[model samples]
Target chain A: MDKSIPSLAQAVADIPDGASVMIGGFGGSGAPIELIHALIDAGPRNLTVINNNAGNGHVGLAALIAAGQVAKLICSFPRSADPRVFNAKYLAGEIDLELVPQGTLAERIRAGGAGTPAFYTPTSFGTDLARGKPVAEFEGRSYVQERWLKADFALIKAEAGDVMGNLTYRMAARNFNPIMAMAARTTIAQVSRIAPLGSLDPETVVTPGIFVNRVVLAENPAQEEVLNRQEAVYP
Target chain B: MTNPAMIDLEAVKLTNAQMAWRAAQDIEDGAYVNLGIGLPELVAKFQPDGREAIFHTENGVLGFGPAPAKGAEDWDLINAGKKAVTLKPGAAFFHHADSFAMVRGGHLNVAILGAYEVAENGDLANWSTGAGGVPAVGGAMDLVHGARRVAVITDHVTKSGAPKLLTRCTLPLTGVGCVTRIYSSLAVIDIAQGRFVLREKVAGLSVEQLQSLTGAKLHIEAPVTDLTAAQVA
Candidate 1:
């Protein structure tokens, strides 16, 4: 129902401090840089951020971490090539880190989005990472039980969207954004362009409007170009 | 005095590209392969001619091509390493759940990865050092368990010259009894019944010399072939 938000500032205004936020990005490919900047300017402290890597360079989530807004980071890879921001903060004990296997992290969020409470997985079944977690055995194989991971808000970036908030993302940029959108209480998508309703092919829609609460047009359509220019970052 | 049995240590180590080329020969046609980051990624570029294997990346692109040439990078098209990639003619992009489901569901025929250590029993430890430092475990855990075959392409030794083929992995394990074969700079080894079987070695490198550098005991297969010199170039 016309869930368009005109400015990034207005979009992130209601996100309170200490919110559990899921950010969408895979090495800056699908990162919502403008929305992240808005979140930084909005100054919400003590945030719990969930993403793939810590951040790439200084543009996306790294800026938020650098600004000291993030209190805890739940991610798969907490170290990047230039992990200066996350590294410095983590070394200083300024932030808490939770490193989940990339697949399990995605599954947990998917479970949350689908309303599944918990699932047992073979991923991390025998490692120290599985320590303290409940283990279940099936067919003589062990699996670690992981609970669903939901967020207070999910800020995502999409290649295209409609006024109704249906989204279509680019190649790898589609990684965590769609799942995070479904798992969050409120999902705000930053898009390069918004088309008229029904203009986008229904089959091409990766995230339907029902999951998206609002859509904010990104300030830079070429924001993702930064991803290619980035040197091979550590995982 | 140098032992007559020990080959010149500095003369015959394979390059990462050569290891990748060797690894590519193991991939069967009509297989679904996942090329892990680093050395394994190079396999995509040197895939065996006349072999057709569909490549999958955990970040949701399948039918991926080799790394894009310089200045041809497309940010939207990237592998797990965050390096720009190209999409093959039949490439498809899906969501994270589906991408990993392809991984965890045993749809992938092979997953070739770089490793910190691979135990003789087929255990792999590549995710972390087990130190108190920040742990970074990506999709290796999922890939190893789900892929039908797991191959590792890594340097033979650590920067300090410690062998990576170990009796037991001292670091946190990514998967136990998961790796099927190992393609290293020095040799191509297979794990069979908890032993490292040497199948191929670099020219001039003797079994005794290789064993001295290896942390695990080795069983040499008959007629160990020397890697062709042209493949190294």
Candidate 2:
């Protein structure tokens, strides 16, 4: 109804260098590939990408990585799928990295949305995890709660959306999109399909419209890039 | 149905006090385990010595150790509830994406969790009771489907004197038939023949009472007797 946030390129064109962002997905399952491509084309430099996985060599977020736009990466690097072939440019002293454990990564984002600055946890104690962190105890045991994390923008992928930005994800695709929607100051959604307002069942919307700041309808259904091979080849 | 073999009836029953030791025995050396929030969280204290299984905290630390001391708290290394925890040697830190991958990737061997309701068919619904006040399932979805073994630890009955075990759970489901074993205050039940087969029970409770409390048919194992920690372990 409100003229769909202009355009994808226009939306991301203003993002400054060194901007912090949270890109939602589980191993490239739910990333906003179209918007990511737009950023790649628009050529924003020194961008810090926070995502589950760097998309495989050719598509998804890898477009930016390949285009040499991402200057730093703050995410849970894929132990299973690395963007080595695509990311070699950055890994060779071209970019910065801050790797967070998967669980702690989610909590930091969630805690940021919950309005908490920081909390303690017991995940990292004696090993290299505690090497640089401050430590303490509870009930004779130790704990370390990480600080909350927030981003200037959060780019997410959803299965369907409405004019109000009420969104839903298909099956496992829901992954981290819903949470990333809440953890950023400006959350943008790239969806496969768009529906009229009130067309979607209220109960089924996983992400409420309030959290979404912009929405883009991806046109390249044929080239809907993702990390997993099955997703790339399907349809 | 009952097993009429000659045996000590006491050995079939499990008391509340023996739960920790019995649960500890389930842990083998070098198994990667996740201790769920609530009662299941207590399992960390009961782990057997000389066994060095890695513990993962959903908050992001793998190779998790015991809780920490006062004035030495690290705000960034906490559990799902923002609680503090200790890290074991060689423990690694990463974002939740990788932590869940480890879980969903079949890297974790066992997950000890608390349950609100368990069905005869192994349907687990521990997330949202849709109650007036309580936290809903936040990470239970990933935990249940990812772990190799899902062990439920809880009391047999509700505080209102009702049973948490039901004929079919009316609460939101966590997974269908995902539960491998159930450890309760009065009994430990295992999945048998598509329903619960009583592995052991607590002292002084009757079979009829157990059945009534379960609200479902349960097959009592042979050689009925009270359960010691050894039997459950």
Candidate 3:
């Protein structure tokens, strides 16, 4: 079945307010900038965004937060290189923040995708972050129980994608894209190139077509860091 | 009464680069290591001549080489610190889940991190200072326990000259009894039996002088070696 979408706007148009979204990126590397801007233009509100960093500057995720679309942020690090946008909103009580350790966050997403309800980990056992979590001891060591994190939608970027939505990411840009693709109900991928069917090698497809729902072509996507370096702000 | 030997010993504290170099000497070859941001990152530059430590960045890629030249950087190819990097021949990329699986599954050999405070009992506190501001923990909480061995590299004292190696961490803790070794500017200490076991100290510094600067009692188990590093230009 062909899952290719015509435009970024149409792909993210159905993401309503109060939806939980997993935006793929570690900092700005794998972030789907065009799709995020399209979501902003679509004007969703009260979004709960799960990402690694809050946002760098006033371009991609920062722009979404600046647009007052995000009601809460579920992330590992909310402070970025230029986190003035998120910081201003969070301090003013305009948005809520749920901070998870980076590895735990990744595991939760993986567990959510794999249909595991919860798992025990030693990541945040004795820290402030582990407060109020269920703890269990195994062989004299304590482990905290962390629940799975599933999202209503996932916006991800890929280097190449086929019409069936089989995707391949570039270098370190593959960080959260593949896992977020599996964890979300509807995964929307923006690819730099839309390869022909049977073009992407089966052995090399990081995210298979079964996990992705919509694939859009963004030939020349704007990079968040470069845009921030230019001090570019969205409308 | 000014003791000239004491003054000379005080002036010879290891610089940050030298401390990093000293820490690099301990990493076993063919080991998968994670170097935290800041001072710990410098350990990558001083890997011994024959030994190689495969670097792991939480962002995804492993076996990454040093940073690319000024204009040669690919923003997509970056480290956990979000700085552009180059991939080594054996480098491989994976999703965040698998990257962390290598960490949380104890597949990594060592994790070297910078710290705010380390208790004599092996507790680490590097995430937050508790001074009313945004708190970002990143991957520190996981790395401390995930890696087989956790080590800290930091200045012996704070900028105001307060001891960082303490009997108890006053700030919030990152992990409980996780750190095994510390590579500080003043000394190389190990946490064994809940005590700070002095293994090495700055040359010419007396044991009494080092203990005066430490917050906790420094235990002398055996003959302490002089902490020295070959000068790197």
What lDDT does each candidate get? 0.86, 0.67, 0.92
Model 2 segments more than 4 A misplaced: A1-3, A79-82, A219-235, B1-233
Q: For residue B108, give model 2's deviation from the true position in Å.
A: 9.9
lDDT of 1 by residue, B1-233 (tens): 12334444557888887888888888899899998887788887676779888999889898988778897887778888877889889999987888889998889999998899999999999988877766788888999899989999988777767788999999889998899899988898999999999988887677888887788998976878886524643
- The Cα error of candidate 1 at residue B141, in Å, is 1.6
Least lDDT summed over 10 consecutive residues: which range in candidate 2 chain B?
B1-10
The better-scoring model by DockQ among 1 and 3 is 3
Best lDDT among the predictions, by candidate number: 3
TM-score of each: 0.94, 0.52, 0.98
Q: What is the DockQ of each candidate?
A: 0.71, 0.04, 0.85
Backbone clashes in model 3, listed as residue pairs? none
For model 2, residues A119-215, the per-residue Cα lDDT tens digits are 7654434323335777787777556658888889888877788878898875344556777788888888888888788889998887888888888
lDDT tens per residue, model 1, A203-223: 888899999999999855545
Among the numbered candidates, top DockQ falls to: 3
Q: Name the docking class for model 2.
A: incorrect
